[model samples]
Target chain A: MWEAADTPNVTKEQLQGAMDQRFSREIRQRLAEARVGIAGLGGLGSHIAVMLARTGVGTLHLVDFDVVDLTNLNRQQYFLPQLGQEKTHALCQLLRQINPYLTLLPQTVRVTEENAGELFREDPILCEAFDQPEQKAMLVSTVLEQCPNTTVISGSGMAGYGSANDIHSRKAARRLYLCGDETTDLAPFRGLMAPRVSVCAGHQANLAVRLILGEETP
Target chain B: MTVTVNGQTQEGCANVLEQLTQMGFDPKRVAVEKNGEIVPRAQYETTPLKEGDKLEVVRFVGGG
Candidate 1:
């Protein structure tokens, strides 16, 4: 368990140096300059953002309109004190704590077809982490049809406490990659759990990193 | 005609839209890709599923 008192005060240069020791100079440079857009700050989005930040993704555009609620605590990357706070704002705070030098763009608004293109126009890769089926389909369709240059990484069917191994990533289309079991659906008996959600989120985040590194296939 | 959908081969000649409906999928809640190219939702009705065409129809569900 980490406490504020135990937090080590480190300079940005020192942190960058530490990261440089792990990843090749070229890889770290690419990650430090990559601008990625993530829509939705729910279970998958929040985790994906944090992972990207930890991996040294320099610029991230986090979009979400919902607020942290009691129900979101089970699988979301938020604490009890963050209840009622907008997801975008709360996630930005957490991400800043991870990498202060990262460029964070937190947008607290519902992403629709009209605004998604404009919001993610500059990003080469867009992660679709919306919860509802309609929203997911809408965003994927919007990006694929309108934003031809942006590759979409989407999550689907990561519900229920099923086998974590069942959740895997795949190249769904030419420019679209999907992460999840691609079959499991939510239900009263098979509710969304933390382990499986994180497993799927890991796939999405890892896939994003791979794509950033020019590894197209999932 | 035998067509593969999501890795499962099925015997049908239905177009993308008709095949999705027959599979009990909500047309508005899924994205379809045929033969390595994305079949836009607007073109689903006109996108013909030829024999041996590979189709990847991904349906979004309620989760994060």
Candidate 2:
């Protein structure tokens, strides 16, 4: 008995076999359609990028101008071999390896007020992983004023002597999520820790997924 | 005498700092704008309240 579902290109038996083997069809479909733009390739950015990539984000626009240094080994996921490599480039390579289907666009340039608009014009959502307060503020303010329709999620104060519970999400304004500490504490500048950065990155990735899924988040 | 803080009308009191504290705001975390000008944190304690004053208190939140 010949069945149409057993076509050579996409056999129903093969498709059913794959479906029965791993992730559900719905999850695979979502991963193929999702496009995420990550701004910053530091500790938080690196973690977020990898998580999103593994989860099936179809395309990733990674923007970062800095190069990897010895200090970054403590928190960033890059290897010592990747030293001197641009953060965006290294991250793109790593993410692509995780999921070969992922389309990675690495922008090896700093995200400045002059270029942020053009950089984000194509991406519907923006994930801010900047470590400097001034830079974060500039990005957030610009996005709010210029690209009103696009959603911006900015990370802040994921450092110092704080429990994972201290990290939180606050809705500072419409389509803007302020994640991490709500204080001007500078302890993280002196010494960057892994737990805080990882927790914050997790929160940022979680929020991004929630937003894309049309789920309510505070 | 009424002053609005976050859209709520509160009775104008003698000391603005006391009123803000009573309203459940930490003095250090908030910035006060009186009559369109930001009142410095130093002035929160001495600043007096007036009738029908519209005060916008901006709080600092962390992110970078």
Candidate 3:
């Protein structure tokens, strides 16, 4: 159960007012009407979802089949109590605490090449945050080939304790934008950490915000 | 012929598949864009590379 402070008491209008104070009302309204999709609920996806939700993106389609485990606590945004629960459920609970009015469509299903196209057809902008290389390639190719209407923001090569400055966001194609250093491969000696993963997540989330607000460049 | 791959100009092969193989990329695991248009995986073998054509092949690396 959420503690008293964990529960949000502010009304939707109050939340709108607070966001408007930070940015212009026009920007806030634009964000409130935009829809974004996330393919994984791991380090990059979880952080990206929270960032987008806090930025007031109206609707999110979150898809992931894995359950939260003890190892996820280091980078993923989940509490110990959420362990053994589906990632979609754990993330939705956290996002609701941030923005109760936001529309969250969470699905507990694995994204495969066969279902990826249909799964994300409704999304205008989809974030590819899968862990394995083949899964990342599958989603990017599926969206670019099958779902021509959706633009993909993908992350790669954010691992280990390397300098955050190496990470970058670049437009690989008209509809695909790639983020991260693009060279750091996960190895036996190199493992993922929070700071680097969050840095890459920031790139993906910021690019998503930019795309929503009609600033698609970069 | 010479073609640009990922903003770096380099020697090109007869087709996208050949060039990708020469450049050490698994054609099955990367997305290719030639002259601003996405080349579907099926076309990689038949898509011919032209001189001065711009190709951006994005390969996924392991990590989050």
Candidate 4:
């Protein structure tokens, strides 16, 4: 069902080479076959999406209801030209440009507890990248309560300018993966900047990749 | 009283719930550990904090 990107007729061998020697061919193959979902398209979600795509992740199920705004330019991976475009569509374009072979399912709708079941069906692992705590909790709890097989990787407290060392990844109750400083709150006293957000995003993406590669920390 | 919360010692506050609120943590979003034992959310108000009591309170943040 997957057509070659162009008439040159590229092969899986070259696709694997995109990952190069840094990642094993076996890992690349595994990544190529893995299907993952990102629940938000904000700073964290966009970064995770890019990292996964660059790692040769074959499929991405992206959901975002918002559009690119000038404010998002500070941290999110989108460019200035992408402004005013629907975030899901803009992100899909960026991802496809990076890896044309990627299979992207971009849904331009807000995900709520009611639709969480339908939105994330069949994906083995989902990254919780919402900017709101209630939304994150809803997706996490909905999937865990309704669909027992799905694993959720979520971030919390990754706000404010702080030391990267403050951020950590913890396996919370159930199958939830929490990545962040665990204490940084977005407040008038503190702000959500790029460095700390990226730190949490890296942790979330790393855990997703590690899980796909079949590594269990326990 | 002094309690070691999230690895830092803090003075005042007698119970876990009170100490959390005093420190600007919303009890609703955080998971608390007292001396390595995970405390049920229901007991935060009743769980008394004593001198040298070590506590680990972790909460989720919003960004990205």
Which one is best on TM-score? 3
The order by descending TM-score is 3, 1, 4, 2
lDDT of each: 0.87, 0.72, 0.92, 0.80
Tens-digit lDDT string for candidate 2 (A1-218)? 12334433645355445644687677656655777788888888899999888666778889888998998998887888889988887787777565555678888888877887778877767888877666776666555445656777778777665788888886655556767876645554655577788888888888877776667676
Per-residue lDDT tens digits of candidate 2, residues B1-64?
7887756788876766877888886665554556654554556789888887777654443433
Q: Could you report the Cα RMSD, in angstroms, for every candidate shown? A: 2.7, 9.2, 1.7, 5.9
Q: What's the TM-score of chain A alone for every prediction?
A: 0.94, 0.86, 0.97, 0.91
Better of 2 and 3 by lDDT: 3
Inter-residue clash pairs, candidate 4: A44-B64, A156-B61, A157-B60, A157-B61
How do the residues A1-218 of candidate 3 rate in per-residue lDDT, one tens digit apiece? 47658675899999999988889999999999999999999999999999999999999999999999998899999999988999999999999988999999999999988898899999999999999888898889878888979999999999998999999999889999999999998899787899999999999999999999999788
Name model 3 segments beyond 4 Å from true. Answer: A1-8
- lDDT-best of 2 and 4: 4
**CAPRI tier for the interface of model 4:** acceptable
| DockQ score for model 4 | 0.26
Pairs clashing within candidate 2? A155-B64, A156-B63, A156-B64, A182-B62
lDDT by residue for model 1 over A1-218, one digit each (tens)? 24556667879889889998998989999998898899998899999999999999999999999999999989999998889999998898788788878999998998887877788878899988988888899889878877878999999988987788888899888888989988787677776788888898899999989999999889
User: Which candidate, 1 or 4, has the higher DockQ?
Assistant: 1
lDDT of 3 by residue, B1-64 (tens): 8999999999989999999999999876688889988887778889998899999999998887
Cα distance off (Å), candidate 4, residue B31: 9.2
Model 3, residue A162: distance off in Å is 0.4
